[model samples]
Target: MAPATQPLLRAALLLLLLLLATSHQATGAVVATELRCQCLKTVSRIDFQDIQSLKVTPPGPHCTKTEVIATLKNGQEVCLDPEAPLVRRIIQKILNNAKSS
Candidate 1:
């Protein structure tokens, strides 16, 4: 490639990346609070011990049972049971929260 062409190529790549990011930012539809989910149910069934490893991502490690569990305003205990789908849902919740903020 010629020397002049190199800068043009770099500039084009950067512009493409910027456009892709802008498009993505515009694509997520705003969802109502009622339509959003906060609790996830267990699928495979897990005991108390498995709850310890739940922390895996940033802002710190995964949430322990004590940390993740919250008492709702209505006095209901919201907790995660480590079954099959439960782990996936918990991870997704964390990721979703990260994206929204």
Candidate 2:
């Protein structure tokens, strides 16, 4: 190939590779988001015993559901449904523990 044409070809190849990489990363991000959404939707219960801390966020005007954010001993956070019976019990336990201390 001609020297002038070689530079242009190399540039075109590099651009193609960059586009492919960007597209792949975007697709991966979409898939990960979808999976996380599915997991959140399907989360009905959690082990309250492992929870180290809990934070309750009051419901907003648009929504009437309060969010209970539980931080586990391992530092992982999970959002719990406040209306759940088990979650209420867990919250009570935490409150009792605090009061006793």
Candidate 3:
């Protein structure tokens, strides 16, 4: 109703809309995976004794193949093929360990 305050109200509304748009863009953003598949290549077998730890990431949107990453005693990481017999046994061992604990 007041002409003098109309400009101020318009500016405040504009600022609110701008802030909302920026915040939404910052929070509701899709983070694209840098590496679609973490393992570009995999080894059929690796010495079981040398492995310090193992991590398995199941197939998902980022990668179509299951990934098995092994950390060696020397702090080195290697990818092992899931289809490999040795790798399967190692995975089974790890799963058994988790179940027992």
Candidate 4:
């Protein structure tokens, strides 16, 4: 190994270790409930006891603008801010989506 590149190699290795350490905190394993997006939907039968806050619209057989704050299956409370369209869209899409089991 060239002595001139030793420092660069050490820095690269350190960066890799740092990334791995932080990623290790959150296991890649996703709970089955988490996979089921319907849990976020108001019409879904899935339980929402874990949700901290919710603002659901009147049930009329269709989804409404009023958002609902709920905890994900992973025991994470997700706040669906009305102002953030990105957040609202992503959550709604996921909650209403179905994946082959």
- Which number leads on lDDT? 3
CA lDDT, every model vs. true structure: 0.41, 0.59, 0.73, 0.44
Which window of ten consecutive residues has the lowest lDDT sum in model 2? 26-35
Candidate 2 per-residue lDDT over residues 3-85, each given as its tens digit: 88998999999989755543312112211122122113213477766778877767665345566666668775666667778
Candidate 2 regions exceeding 4 Å error are 1-42, 61-63
Per-residue lDDT for 61 in model 3?
95
Q: TM-score of every model?
A: 0.25, 0.51, 0.63, 0.28
Q: Rank the candidates by lDDT, best first.
A: 3, 2, 4, 1
Predicted structure with the largest TM-score when compared to the true one:
3
Question: Residue 10: error of model 4 in Å?
Answer: 0.2
Using TM-score as the measure, name the better of candidate 1 and candidate 2.
2
Any residue pairs clashing in model 2, and if so which?
Answer: none
Backbone clashes in model 3, listed as residue pairs? none
Winner on lDDT (2 vs 4): 2
lDDT, candidate 4, residue 69? 46
Q: Model 4 compared with the native: what TM-score?
A: 0.28
